[model samples]
Target: MPTRRRFIKCLIALGAGLLPWSGWSEMLKIVNHQAAQAAILTNDSSAKTLDLIHPKDVSYLYHTAADDISALTASDFQGRRAGTVGEEKAAAYLIEQMKGLGLEPLGDLINKNTRNYSNAFTVYPVIEEFYNGRLTFRPGNSQDLRTPCANVIGGIMGKNKSESVILSAHFDHLGIFQGHLYPGANDNASGVGCILDLVRQLVQEGVKPKCNIVLAFWSAEEMGFVGSFSFLQNPTFSLGGLKAVFNVDTIGNGALNDFSVWASSDNEAVQAIQSAASEHNISIPLASHEGYNSDQVYFNLDHLPAVTLMARDWLNKNHTPDDVPDFVNPEKVALANKILYKAVKKIAY
Candidate 1:
């Protein structure tokens, strides 16, 4: 591992290739570090905060995912189904990104170079098809097909390692169906994008958490949360050691600047997130309800702290070919990224 100074310098060395303007290079420096050691919340319930994290930092923390979504949802991805060529491409890209960002390997994995950064498993996909708004699983015979899948994991170590906050998003989506490709840009590509961008910031900005922050890109989620559930069953770290789980899914659409964090009303993570969202003035709403569609369901079922931020118009072109990149709002995607980052900081910092 590089020294903290070298890691910070790596941010600068990432260089001008991705910057919209080369002159903005100076702006990317860590000019403000007040938020680094803040308590993350105030004594007063209404006064939570993450100080001096400028607005453009959201773009810096978010654009990569947007750019990644474009790549991940492109023709190369073929909708990113588990055990397929498209899914393998997506996993390779995630491993490459994790390596580039200098995150530590959490545990063992099928690929030695990837370490725990890539966990491959044999998952039974729960294929669903909808007709006239009625959803049904594919036939019994089809259910017998078990395929090898991969999940990408990485994290930032904090001062306290006994417990950690998890930031997750599934990278898998429905592959081609009935001869039409399902782009799955908003269904999940957007969520994975957010995870990538946040981890990138934690890596480059030298912002260490008080508790470790674990980032996971689940596989085979489209197959009924198999990836997340599998990890929960056999995680490198203990499930009991988890402080909270923040999941992002389908965050690329519905009201250009608005999003919703879905969770049960009694869940404490919701209130903490509400306070954090208020402090940051992020354009996000908390929708208190149990959601069975996304990966948060398993955590919620186990009575663990879990919440997911997703686009309100998640049904728009969802699981279909129309969930393409040109339709996503970069600004809105950036806002969701900001809210998730802030929420994670509130919990771990």
Candidate 2:
């Protein structure tokens, strides 16, 4: 595979042709290029192997959750807005984490020599306005308003590769608006952190699932679910083979022991989640909704079985500068991690 620097340079070159904002594109190209090079030089050489001893205790879980959230909410990521340098940097970070976990790359497999974990896609301008905090899509195509984005994907292959289960979290948030940063800690960093720790525990314990377990970190979710919509339109794997999709979002900053789950329908996926919560002694309140929010929307629209887990006050710090890591509850995040881990295991194993 090409070095990270070379890969980003290629992406920047390709993006220049598609984007009309020459000044913005040029600035990002320079920033991303330098950042990618710096990352390569300082990259850790040690692989995250099972041989490395770790105390799999409650404290460790809290530490891991805090670490992941802090990293994502760091100022260097600049809010991780879609189609921006910050989002690209976050994607690069996820790629490294997935690599460390020994996951198989399931995106950009066309070029064997440069296979990567990025499923690059374009987000066309469609929304006319945000009426009552809800987006209304425009009818006609506006090619000039297209934005570039990508989804980070990795997976653990199981004995039955023909079937798969997906655990997803969107890493994108509203970028700096009006000169203030919306750090997106509880909005989504919590979800990403929870999934990362969950997978880490699974790998460390050597649990071999029956169906492939895909870890998908979606981009452009704040942009009306464009990344996931694109994935559904042109998936890297066979969508028909997907047994279930469990999406985690905003699982921090709420009541310490309170959580909510909404499903596409009353199906096996929902049953699996309920069973996992019951077995693991986790409290997850099951509820019913239209499933129009979060990354699960596209899958639900396709009539595919999906569910979303949430544990945050939507009107509190969401999309605001106050949404910083300080507000995130590590205990709550760890609880979410445990719930998702057990739920996915029940379905995949």
Candidate 3:
């Protein structure tokens, strides 16, 4: 809200008595101008394209908390309905949609009898026996239950296997607690929407990657990256061929104008993201290993590079009931998806 002239005037006043007011003001202007010019120097520092995805649709992704997300937050165990039932339902629905989008199955997973979709992975197992009742307030901890948990993953094999990329999001969310249900409208349903939208875009645009593109919808991420970890343990494709992984963990929590990127310096995904961001004039709150978190962890652990891009700071409504659909900014999610598509086009190709 503060004007450039006012900013310079303040700077001049701060530097007064040390130099002439006129000279200080001139020097401040030159410094400010140079700073602004410096911002334009790098290709990865500017936003070039944004229309790749629509703004209104992005808003829709955030505000539409359709379907249940409680599955991600459910406490299931081995052999039992590990995690949440809602999560399992979400995974099933995602697989059906991916198949509808024409993604080919890479191998036999989960049931092993079927090769139609990616296998399921478990993030955490709820040992019902651990509940002392009085010690913890969470439900069903008193019963021993082995819940079978899994995340749905699919991919379009790239022309060049060695240069593959991953586009991922978590589809599971907090289940019902007591008599109430946590719809998880924005806590992550928004991310799933963005992912789905991208799938629609790829199918419509006939965009094929030089490198394989993995559409990953992680499970149990809310339980400490369980589903992602499981998938990495037994991936359908060779991890050696991976170039980078792009994760969309949460993007509809805030207004559409702001976005954030968490990337590891140890990988090449950082440059790819920076390049796309700059070209589209997108502003990214950048980071290195210090604050990077998302489904990209699997690749990072395997020494493969990756990035986590989102539209807003998820901590505000993260893990809370307030993370509903209305609080999400759809335009931001759409833009993030657009940027992601651009990044894929540049990096994988």
Candidate 4:
């Protein structure tokens, strides 16, 4: 039998030193990942003794993340509108809270002078003028339009560390409209909170996947996945190395215990989602569905593997002032995270 101490030693030897004060739950997850790594290096079949980790250990992640959903959607953020001071504040908040997660700063998108983790980009938003009987578009925006939005990122490397898997969510929402701030709690603040909680907790336990985990908080999704599209076109890193993408968006409605997934017939991505849903006791009422309404659509349409999670009834509370954090159910957000955790674990390996 592989002793726990030996597993710890093996992890340190492989350059994944323990923090010494990590709890048993954290230790368990790290031990399992390191054991699997050791087995691969030694080519020893018996070394494949990694146990199925219990999800209960990291339950704190869900709670903290769920609770913070309110903060992310608070009036202080001014709706986290893409290209506005609100969006910048939200990005700064995420970067600050997400420190030490092993994520490298994205290319020139991030401000070079500042330490905020962001993928800043300049996008030419189409401004349509409703003049006469026709509408025409011009590249770029007027003074009032938000021009500079940022995508936030972080990561945890799996075994290979070269192949990549993306866990994404859009954090931008409609700005103040008609004297109302679109709190955007459900539009995607919840999604952002969930992914952050999921990645931060896993990294806390030093749990590594079998492929690099890319944590992407996209911007300008309201303007049509501008941030994600930018990254795909002129990637700081290649998307060709991407194995899969899981997008979280608008999951704060519907039955608090249920979820809806938009996954096509792509076997690897679809099957993994189904399997993880089943294992985690999350209900995916249908085996296959397709949607192009959210950030994942950019990847899925281009033939890159992707899946999206949203509520079946999210349409009710989305894109309005009512979409405030008060409408977000923390329990459901936590459950969504659990399902993704299982799904990512299954796919990354």
Candidate 5:
């Protein structure tokens, strides 16, 4: 039986030393290629031993204070408009926080002069002008509710180009529907809070990566991953150089009392991620549902390794007005973040 400590040690040995990005990339290719061949030869038995460890032991407590903050942003807060007033404000706030945490805003610098607090993809311009400034399911109804939205982007550059990791989540929620303010507590505010805390952790440790860490707070994801899709088209860094992306969306209220990770089928990075989770006794249920639905869709299409993380199997509250705070389990959310942090460090560093 492979113990957790030995598992981590194996990963560390895979890198040997984390100083060069090319070396790490090369190592990843070799290990993943071997794993792939092994899978083909053996009939996918790798999962047999991997899934035995229980996921409950590694779960972390959801911080009450963090939950409160997420509640205010996703559910309790006012409107967020994409490329407009409210969303711009939210984007600015996120950038300020990132700057305060010692991370340089890489997206803006990459985009150059047009760089504002927020990063704009071309789709937002069309949505704001043609769609009449609302993220809607209805095509031609005035009664369609409007969502406040914004896309916040920031990054800490890695040691070099070949190795990069993206940490992303959507912060925008349904603004107003049927004269009631929709508090999207679990719908996505939880994801935003988790990303923010992850940023803080990276800053606190001052642990720079061998590849860059890009943090994005997408806007209008509910409106079809508009913000993220746009960013993907005009990414700050080349998509080919991207190592992996972790997309956290709607990470609240799971009926199963646990969460799962959905990894794209073409990605080889999933093995390393699974190995990392196994070290912590966390179970990541894998899937390959591709609809370009979330921010991860762009990354997936770009042929990069990517995965979406969220509390699994939540019913009913997906896009309704009832998706408010109190129902969310912050303990579950924090546990997800811890797993995310470990997965990120293992892959990026």
Candidate 6:
């Protein structure tokens, strides 16, 4: 049997068109249904029986999430900082994954091009200065600096194309600060992995949502939610019909079984998340508060009902060099994926 790393590499190569589908037949067999069933039955006694979707399906998705985290945290991506070559590489990788999953590009809808998966934007980051013990932000000029970044957007159309639900996570981290690498595995890569696996599970199960499901991999979130704000300013879809935005971030750390949720308001979206948790037998301690940071902040500022799911004890390694894949727990990431999957399904389906 091929190792998981080799299997993931083959999948990436296949998605990038470097390998033909016929050539990957043998490698694809590594994920055979029988193997998945055996793995689940042996590993998780509770999953010996089936549920809404096959337990084996969940196992496959879980492995995919782990693979995604590994890929994102790899050194080749250079911490995936916005405007850097590493970030570009990460975006290309994500585009290939989206294409492989049969998701349509939701970026650059006007231009039917190969690079349409990227929603390009420029960020003239504001310069902050402390004046008289008060922090102030000034408009960046040419003397300052400007960074070119893009958000990778993909989606699956639903029965009602007019309405949409967004499942988003930021893909950018603090590049390399002072000669140290911040892998950002738990800070956000975990969230991105969970969303990718959620999409994979939805596609594999042939689930047709009631509203369009947009998978947004935001960029430059560390620079104050720039990518999401850019999307709002120039949206490719109708914002009026947006049902809700479910954001996941920093779920790979802290207690494995403990989860926290912050919503813009106590709306149907929150209720949907709570109901999903209940149905899925996951415990989510709901905490409603204002000014919770993450990619969801922009949407909340626009009066959109959005909810963010995260775990505790993330601040210690958030932007440090210690934030690496070694510290991320696959089970915690898998749990986050399951909760988001059910919650999004409750709303979109």
* Tens digit of per-residue lDDT, candidate 2, span 222-267: 8778888988988898878889898998888777767777765666
Estimate candidate 6's alpha-carbon lDDT, on a 0 to 1 scale. 0.75
The TM-score, computed over Cα atoms with residue i paired to residue i, of candidate 6 is 0.76
Best by TM-score, which number? 1
Model 6 residue 109 distance off true place after TM-score fit, in angstroms: 3.2
lDDT of 3 by residue, 1-349 (tens): 1354466567666767577755564455444543343334434334232112111222122222232232233333111122655566566666766666667665445465546465654343432221222111123343454456766777766667665677777766555444344555665677777767776555443445667777887776655566778878887667787777878877876655567777645357766776777778866766543533677776667777877777656666565556666666667777777877788777665
TM-score of each: 0.79, 0.76, 0.68, 0.73, 0.69, 0.76
Alpha-carbon runs more than 4 Å astray in model 5: 1-68, 71-76, 79-84, 109-117, 122-150, 255-257, 288-292
Report the lDDT tens digits of candidate 6 across residue range 79-156.
887888888988998887887777878887655654378899977765544444322334567565687889999888
Worst 10 residues of 5 by lDDT: 53-62
Clashing pairs in 6: none
Span of ten consecutive residues with least summed lDDT in model 6 = 50-59
lDDT of 4 at 211: 78
lDDT per residue for candidate 1 within 1-349, as digits (tens), equals 1354464556555645545563444435342222232224334332343331222233343347777888888887888877789999998887777666666666556455556677667775455678555333453355487778878887777777888888889998777767777878887888888778877676555556788788888898877788888887788777677888888898888786566777654476766666666766654566654434678878888888888878777766766678888767767777777776777777887
lDDT (Cα atoms) of all candidates against the true structure: 0.71, 0.75, 0.59, 0.69, 0.61, 0.75
Which is superior by lDDT, 1 or 5?
A: 1
lDDT of 4 by residue, 84-153 (tens): 7888888887776555344555445434553346777865555533334322234455454447777887
Model 2 pairs in collision: none
lDDT comparison, 2 vs 4, better candidate: 2
- Comparing 1 and 6 on lDDT, the stronger one: 6
Question: How many steric clashes does model 5 contain?
Answer: 8
Which consecutive 10 residues in model 3 have the weakest lDDT in total? 50-59
